[model samples]
Target: MKQPLLRYPKALVLLFTVLACLSLRTVTAQEIRIVTEELPPYNMTLNGQLTGMSTEVVQAVLKEIGVQASIQSMPWARAYDIALNAENVLIYSILRTPQRELLFKWVGPVAPTHWHLFAKPGSQIQLNSLDDARQYQTATVKQDAGEQYLQSKGFTVGKNLQPSNKYTYNYEKLKSGRVDLWIANELNALYLVRQAGDDPTETLVSALSLPDLGGDNGQNMAFSLKTPDALVERFRQGLQAIRSDGRYAAIAQKWL
Candidate 1:
C-alpha cells in the first residue's frame, strides 16, 4: 500500500512524452530552405533585399511558425533541381504542373497568376490555339515554367532568353527579331515592357486570351521529395495558417 501511493500515473508519463515530442517538433521546424527563381511580383530580390509578393507571403508564414528560412535565387532549373534533390529545400511560386507533381511536397496558392504570350507590337500572331504560334520561334527563360510547358508539348524553343535575369535584353531580342514570341506572366510582361522604356502598348503585343498552361495560378511551396513527412506536414500547416488568417491575401495584394 505504501509503494502504491508513490506510483506515477501512466497517463502522466504519456502526456509528458507527447509534450517532449512537440517540443522537438518545434525545434526541428525552424530550418526551412527556399530555392527560387527571380520571378518578379513573386520571389525576387529588390535593391539587394528579398522583396516580392510571394517572398513576403512566405516570410509571413515562416514568422507565424517560428521558422527560419534561407531563400536562394537561381536559375529555374537549378532551383527546381535543388528542391528535388537537396534536403530541407523548397521552391517557390511555381506553377503546379502534372509533370512536376511527384517531385515534391507542395504548399500554397500564396497568389494566382496567368500566363501571357508576348510578341513584337507589329506582329500579327493570333492565338487561336497554342499551335497558332508554332511557325514563329518562341523564346523563353531557360528552364522556366513557361518554357517547360511549351517544350513539353513539342514546341521548338528558339533561344534561352532568360527574363528575371534581364528583361531588357530579351525585349531587345524581340525588337531585333531574334525571338518571335516570349511567354511570360501577364503582370510581369507588362511590368517588363514598361521598365524597358518601350511603350507597353506599341512594343509588346500580348495575346488576347491568356492560356492556362496546366498549372495552379500561383505555384506551390515545394519540399524536396526526400524531406521527412512529418516536416512536410508542418510546412503544410504553416501555409494553411496564412491562408486561413487572410494573411496570404494581404501579402499578395502588395505585389498584385
Candidate 2:
C-alpha cells in the first residue's frame, strides 16, 4: 500500500504547491528574482561579496517582509531587460526617469543622485546648453540613462554618442581622448575616478548639469509589471519600516 502522504489526492498536492509558490506567507528566496548592476556605493561587488547602500536596504526590506531573495549583478541593459519583462523580478538603484515612470512598480527612493556631463580636466568642451554639446562625442553605457537622455536629445550613435557596455570603459575612452565627454551621476563619477586611483577633482570636471534626471526619486527599488500588487506593497511597507526605524539611514550613512 502507498504511504499516507502519497495516498493524498494529486490535485490537493498541486494546490499546496501552488499556494507555497504564490502565497507570500510561504514564498521562498528563490521565487523572486533580484537584479542590479555594478553601480558603486549603490550596488557593487566588494571582495567578491555584494554589499552596497541599496543592496543593504533591499536586504533589510526582505527581512522585514519575511521574504528572501538573492541579488544578481549584471550589465545594466540586461538587468533592466529582465526587470522589464520577467515575472516577480526586482530591480534596484534605478533612476526613476519620466520615460521609465510607468515601467515598474516602485518601492523606495533609495537615494538621490545628481546627473552631470563630465569632461577631462582642462578640457575645452564648454557647453552652455544641450545643443552646444552636439558637436562632441560623448561616451555612454548601453541603455544607461545617459545614453537614453542623449538619444532623446537627437544625439545619434556612431556620430555624437559612443555607447559601451561598461561604465569603466567610458573613463578609459575619455582619458584616451576618444570621447570628449561622459555623462554620469556625481557619486558614480567620483567613485570610479577614486577607484582608478585618480582624484576626481583633478581628473574630471563637471561640464554640464542634467537637471532632467534629478529632483525626486533619483533611484528606486522596482518590481516588474508581472509581479503581484500585494508583493510590491509588502516591499513598499518593508522599506517604509526600515526608514522609520533608522535602518535605511544607517545604510546610507555607511555608504554615502
Candidate 3:
C-alpha cells in the first residue's frame, strides 16, 4: 500500500510552477527607470507627447536592446536625485562633468549643444566676448549644468531669478527684462522663440562660446551606478547599432 495512488494535485502544482517561473522572469528582465525635467527640444512634451531629440534617440536605443523603460517628467532636481539614489535609474542628455563622471554609468554624445546668450530686442547689452557678459545679471536654471558652468567661470548671477523647470521661462525673463543675460543651447533658444511666434529678426541670440565647455557639447546619457553591467553593455551595443545604421543621424536631422 505504498504510494500506489496518492498523486498530489498535478494541475495545481503545474499552475503554481508556471506562475513562479513568470514571476522570476519578470524580476530578471532588465528595466531602466527614467526621470527627466522639462528641457525643451530635448525632453519637453508637445501636445502631451514626450517627443524630443534626446527622447527619440534614447527610445530607439532602448528598443534595439529589448529593454523597457518608464519615463517620468518631473523637476530636474528630483530626477537627478532619483537617479543618484535609486537602482536601475538613469538621467539623460546630461553633461558629463568630472564630478558626475564617477557617479553613474554614461552613454551617448547624442548631439552638440551650443550654449548661447539671448537678449531682448533693442537692449544695449553687447557681448563682444564671454567676458563682456559677466558684468550683467544673468538668469539660469538653479543647479543646472549651465549655472554650474557659469558659476565656475566666475559669472555672477544676480537675484537668482525663479528656477526655470523649462526653457520657456528664458523667453519670459528676456521679455520682462528680468534678466540681462539668459544662457541656453542655441536650438532650445530657437524653439522658445518659435513657440512665442516671434521671428529671429525680432530678437538676437549670440553664442557665448565657453571653449572649455564647448568641447564636450553636453550631449550625454547616464545610468545609475546600480544598473547592471550586462544591461549597460546592451545599451552600448544598441547605441552602436543605431549610430552605425544611421538611425542616430536621422533623429538628429529631424530636430537639429
Candidate 4:
C-alpha cells in the first residue's frame, strides 16, 4: 500500500496551511448582521436608507475588512435581545458600560453621547442627581442604555420609570407633561424635538447631566459574545485604520 502524500512532513505542513487559510477565508466571508435604532446623528433611516455617524463608521470598517453588511433598524429591546443572543451580530452606538463590558466584544468609540435629564421648558422639576430624578416619572425607551442605567440605580419600571418601546413616545410624553423627566441622549433628544417640529432649545430644557450613568466612555460598536475573536479583532483593526486615515473624522463631520 502506498503511504498517503499528506502524511509526509512537507505535504502535511502544506495541507495544514491550506486548511488554515480556508478557515480564515470562511470566517471573513461570514455575513455580519448589524442592529441599530432610529437615533439620529448616530444611526437612523433617511430617505429610506440607513445612514448616520455610527452607520458610516461601521460601513467603513466593513469595507476595510472586505465584508458587506446591511444595518437594520428596530425597537431597542428587540435589537438588544438579538445582539445578545445571536452570532455575527453587531450593535453600534452602544454605551460601553461596566455592566456590559464583559457581555460583548467591543470595537470602538464610534461616537460621543451625553445622557441628560430633560424637562419641559419652565418646569419646576430639577434633578441634581440620579436620585433626584427618581422622585418623578422618568420616560425612557425600553431596553435602552438609559433605561438600564436608571434601573441599575434603583428606578423601578412602571413606577418611577416609564418604559416606552419607542423613543419618540418618550419625547412626546415629556412634551405633553405626562412624564416629569426624560432621560435621553442630548443629541438624540434635540433631533427628536426638531423632527417633531419644535425648537429643542425652546421646547426642552436640560435640567441635569447624567454623566457616566451608563459609561463615561464614548459609544462603541459591540459584537455578540458568540462572535469569533478573530472577526472582532479584524473589525477593531479596521476601525483603527479608518481613524488613522481621516475617514472616521470625515464621516463624523458630516453628521455633527
Candidate 5:
C-alpha cells in the first residue's frame, strides 16, 4: 500500500494539469458571432459570397486584428435580435440612433445611410415634411430603422405602416400600389430596383428625406454589451488602422 501511494499521486497530478490546460484553452477561445442583413450595397450575398460595403469594412477590421469569424446574413429582425440578446455577437451596417446608444459597444462610421420615403414614379405623393407622410401607407422592412422611426412617430403597423420581411418586398408593394410609399436607404432602393430589372429613377422617386434616422450619424459595427471592452478596443483600433492605411477608403470606393 505504501509503495502504491507514490504512483497514484503522480498520476493524479498529471491528470489535473491536463484538465487545467484544456479549460484555459476553452476560456480563451470564445466565439465571436457576426450577423448582418441583406441591405444591398451595404451587406448582401452575391454569388453565395458575403460581400458589400459594410461587409468589406468589417472583414478588413477582422483581418487587421488577426481575428476570424464567419459573417451570417439573415433578415434584419432576426439578426438584430441575436445581436441584442447573445453574448459576443456583433452587428454591422447599423444606424446608431439615440434609442440604441446604450444597448451595445460601438465601432466605426462604416458608411452613411441616407434614408428616404420613396414613391412610385409619377405618383402624386408630395411630402412637405415627415408629418405629411402620415396619411399614406408606407412599406417598411420589419425591425429596420425606418420602420422603428415611423413607429415612434405614431405610424401603426397593419395600418399606415406596412411591415414586410424584405426590402425587395416593400419595393414590390410600392410598385403594385399596395403601399403608397416605401421607406428605405436611397442607395439600397436604387440597387434593389436594378436587381429587380428596372431603372430606379423610373421605378421609384424620393418622397421625403428622413435625416434623423441616419443622416449624419452613419452606420457602425456594434458588439453586444457583454462583449469584453478590450475586444471592442481591438476592433476599434483595427478599424482605425485600416482607415490610416487607405484600406477603408479603398473598400468604400469599390462599393460606394
Candidate 6:
C-alpha cells in the first residue's frame, strides 16, 4: 500500500487460504438439536442419562460424522413439533408413515416396531380387523403416530378414541377398565406392563395387529425440512457407515 501493492508471498497466501477454509467450515457446521421421548428400550432416561437402542444408534451416527450433540427427552408431541419447525433439529424413534413422508428428511430405519391393540387379559374385546377395533373405546397418546394411524382408519377421538397426553395414562386407563383397548407397540407394551408391576404376558393380550403403517420400514430419525440437504446426507451416510461397520448391530444387540 505504501508503494504499489504487490502480490503476497505464496506461502502467506496459502496460509490465509487454509485459515479461511477452516473458519468457513467452523461456521457452517450444523449444530444439531437432538430430541426424543421416553419410549423405553428405544429412547428413555436411565440413571439421569439418555440410553436406549435408538439413542445409541443416533449417538453412533453423530460420532461417525464428528458431531457432538446432546440428546434431550421430552414429550413425543413436543419433540415432533420441534423437529418439524426448527432448523437442525432431529427427532428419533419416529415412525416413518406415509402421512409423514414429506414432512422431514429421514436418516434411518433405526429399529423395527409393530403396532397392536392391547386389552386386559380375558377381556371380551375382540378385534379381528381395524374396523372391529372401532366399536370399542381405545386409549391412545395425543398426536402420536399410532393415534394418527387409527384416525386414518376412521377412528374418531372423543367418540371411540380416548386421547391422553402420555402413554402411561393410556395404560392406566386400560388397567382401570376405563378403555377397552390400548394402542401400543409390541415391545413397548411389554416394557410398560413390566413397569406397571405386572406380567406383560398375563396383563396384556394382543387383540389386533395393525399392518405396517410406518411405510413398511420402521422407526427413523427425522430432521427438520429446513435443515441443509448436505447435513441430512451426511447423517444418512454416517448411519449407513455405522450399519456397514458392525457398530449398529452391536448397539442393537446391547438393548434388543
- Could you say which candidate leads in TM-score? 4
Q: Per-candidate RMSD vs. true structure?
A: 4.1, 5.6, 7.1, 2.3, 6.3, 4.3
lDDT of 5 at 75: 94
Model 5 C-alpha lDDT per residue in residues 1-256, reported as the tens digit of each score: 2566566888889988798656534432557889999999999998999999999999999888777888899999999999889888889989888778898899767987898899987898889998899999999999888888888888899889999988889988998999999999888999999999998767888889887778644789999887767677778999999999999889878977
Residue clash pairs of candidate 4: none
Compute the lDDT for candidate 4: 0.86
lDDT of each: 0.72, 0.87, 0.73, 0.86, 0.86, 0.84
What is candidate 2's lDDT per residue for 19-60, written digit by digit as tens? 855686544455789999998888999999998888888888
Better of 1 and 6 by lDDT: 6
Clashing pairs in 2: none
Task: Give the local distance difference test score of model 6.
Answer: 0.84
The local lDDT score (0 to 100) that residue 87 gets in candidate 1 is 78
Which segments of candidate 3 are over 4 A away from where they belong?
1-31, 156-162, 214-217
lDDT of 2: 0.87
Arrange candidates by TM-score, descending. Answer: 4, 2, 6, 5, 1, 3
Candidate with the larger lDDT of 4 and 6: 4
Error of 4 at 167 (Å): 1.3
Model 6, C-alpha of 150: deviation from truth (Å): 0.8
Model 2 regions more than 4 Å off: 1-22, 26-29
Which model, 3 or 6, shows the larger lDDT? 6
Q: Give the range where candidate 4 is weakest over 10 consecutive residues by summed lDDT.
A: 210-219
Pick by lDDT: 1 or 2, better one: 2
Better of 2 and 4 by lDDT: 2
Candidate 5: 10-residue stretch with minimal lDDT: 21-30
